[model samples]
Target: MKRVFIIAVAIVTLLVSAEAQKQKVGIVLSGGGALGFGHIGVLQALEDNGIYPTIVAGTSMGALVGAMYANGLRPQDIFDLVKAEEFDKISKIITPSGLRRGSMGISDHKNILDMLDKYIPANDFDSLKMPLYVCVSNISKSQGEIIHSGGRLHEYLLASSSIPLVFEAVELDSMYYVDGGVFNNLPAQAIRDKCTYLIGSNVNPEKYRSPIKSGKDVAMRSVSILIYENTKPGIEMCDFMVDVPVNYFYSPMDFKHFYEIYQIGYKAGLDYIKEHPEIVRKCKGKRPDW
Candidate 1:
């Protein structure tokens, strides 16, 4: 009887291990300022429900949180970090002059980079426990690229978050970089073919569409189209699009608004997964072949 019990326990352990290996989840995070910070609650809800991504690809602010998550920080910890005054101080550098002149005068860029490094040192993306891919806009070529294999985490984060004139373009290895959203807003294309399942945590509302009228608008739209076409295909897609007003992106970030944004994203994500039982089932290791 003792031998039989031990065998049963070993069998159960092996089954659990196999299930874990079979589950390949990819989380795609979108850009939206303090809006993007809402991803914290979305991630929290997923984790609460036993859903954790095996891989993650994020744009702009999403990349910042994703990088921290990849480095082993939990959602609550990320929230705490953001709530800290130190993080808010970084945004103060984006002045009206910075936007008009295309320069953040003081190079708070360095300060931002330094702060991130203090908490999470620059490490190879491939070396992270869970692989994280950061989507960045290649300014020189006006294209989108995923920084997955290896690079300074700070550089990747900076490149992904640099919102054109608002935040000065970062120079690295002789190339200028800007926000990834300019090309791929949600960055769904970054991990489409790399995983069996994908969860797109988008802060941008689904109904919001760009009203393009000018020459520059057309060019931006064209770039978006090209990047969208290049994004990989053939993955199970689960979308969580938060309903935030267009004006919110232009507003200043504060604890009150941050909390509200988080609630909006968290509820949307929770409701989405609840309605889509298939997504929940996949995350919990119930689907083996799909």
Candidate 2:
């Protein structure tokens, strides 16, 4: 009888240990314009390994992807949306007013807003399946704002990704907002306190290998330098990071290379997962065939 009691106690203790080890994982996605499309591939790889984020935080392009995922659209669905020719038309169709913006931006904000309206199912944070924190730069205040709620979801997405000089700033509640990458490109700090484990995906290239030939290239390279400098702190906060190898040649507006970039992201994610067996162990019983 004593032996039976000892065995029961041991089993209970093991079960308790397993339960305690189950952690709330949060993913932080960094901004990289069209390179951000790679985030979808990383997310797909995570799902394939049965690792789903309990919370997600992002800046700029990251915010757009994170918001869609938080609304319950699978990565594959997002991939399809981005790869479709319709997306190319909508994103590139510039209005005469947009072209004449002189110093504001070359593209129309309404085009992307219309795209978001058609795709995203939810309009508010509370309605989402998972908590999503979107980081945007409050240009009026010269500060970064982390938006977890309030205002329209699509507007927040637009504001978060509104690249300075490329797309016009989004106005919300009488405040002007622009790309979050100008402040915090990798917003790991936003979800650091919310999750027990953190995963970060950085799509920015480590260095610019090509010459800056155009005004657009100059803007992109300048932003890349700023984002790269500010990303160190966020990198240190992650338990694991998937670094997608996007290069200088792949401009922010290179929608044509979305599939190639996405595949690179997937491979990077798989490589990270293989290297971190502890992550796999933690997600036991949930593993899917890769």
Candidate 3:
């Protein structure tokens, strides 16, 4: 039943995202969840890019990390505990904490998180208000927004479909501090000062305006836009990410071959969510708070 529900949710969410691109380019955006910390840089970069894109940040604890914990991999704790290629321990964490992990709100304290959160001061986000202090989570989704990642992931899929991209906040899910608190989306306060229903947090109408918001999760109202088809006339365009590389996708970000690394990451993200439909279909589940 759960698997079937998840697949159905995945199909619907992807379909909706696929369908939203009405203009020259259809853009979807999201930040680090499946991965961690670096996603923030990606978001800030998007913000810095003159184009104002709709930003939808999710809570790391609720839909994003909670789901992972429920599934057992303890995804939020990945950074602090496993410093390097510790895939074995990672896989093990998921197995024990999965929905099948038993128990209620929290499954096992003995499970690495307790020790990691307790002994390791790095994972906690109290009083740190720095650039990446809101590290509690990588992706954003609270009790209500299960489709956050899927929605953001959809943006990348659009690029893969070759729809003539203007700008996309690519592979943002695996880039931020997943286990910390995030009030700083003070990375907060929209720079555009004022925006429309679709515009995001960092958008600046006087600039490379985008209808995306950087801190929320609701989808945009369907409207006509000549976005990706062609960069609007007079709109100075730039693709800073071109040479940026795929290293961001594979943490400890390798400066070696930037674009190539991110290129791989970009594709991997698309393939991952698409291949694992069950994982994405979330919202419908009974949450702990409820």
Q: Best by TM-score, which number? A: 2
List model 1 lDDT by residue over 251-281, tens digit each: 3234246777777667776787777767777
Q: Can you give the lDDT of residue 6 in candidate 3?
A: 100
Residue 215 lDDT, candidate 1, scale 0-100: 90
Which one wins by TM-score: 1 or 3?
A: 1
Candidate 2 displacement at residue 195 in angstroms: 0.8
Question: Considering lDDT, which of the candidate structures 2 and 3 is the better prediction for this target?
Answer: 2
- Residue pairs in candidate 2 whose N, alpha carbon or C atoms collide under 3 angstroms: none
Query: What lDDT tens digits, residue by residue, belong to model 2 across residues 119-210?
Result: 76557788877789999999999999898976588888888998887787788888899989888889999988777788899888574344
Give the candidates in order of lDDT, highest first.
2, 1, 3
- Of the candidates numbered 2 and 3, which has the greater TM-score value? 2
Instruction: Give stretches of model 2 more than 4 Å off.
Output: 1-23, 88-97, 101-103, 205-220, 283-290
Which residue ranges in model 1 land beyond 4 Å of their true spot?
1-23, 85-107, 208-256, 285-290
Sort the candidates on TM-score, descending order. Answer: 2, 1, 3
Give the worst 10-residue stretch by lDDT in candidate 2.
281-290
Distance from true location, Cα of 135 in model 3, Å: 9.5
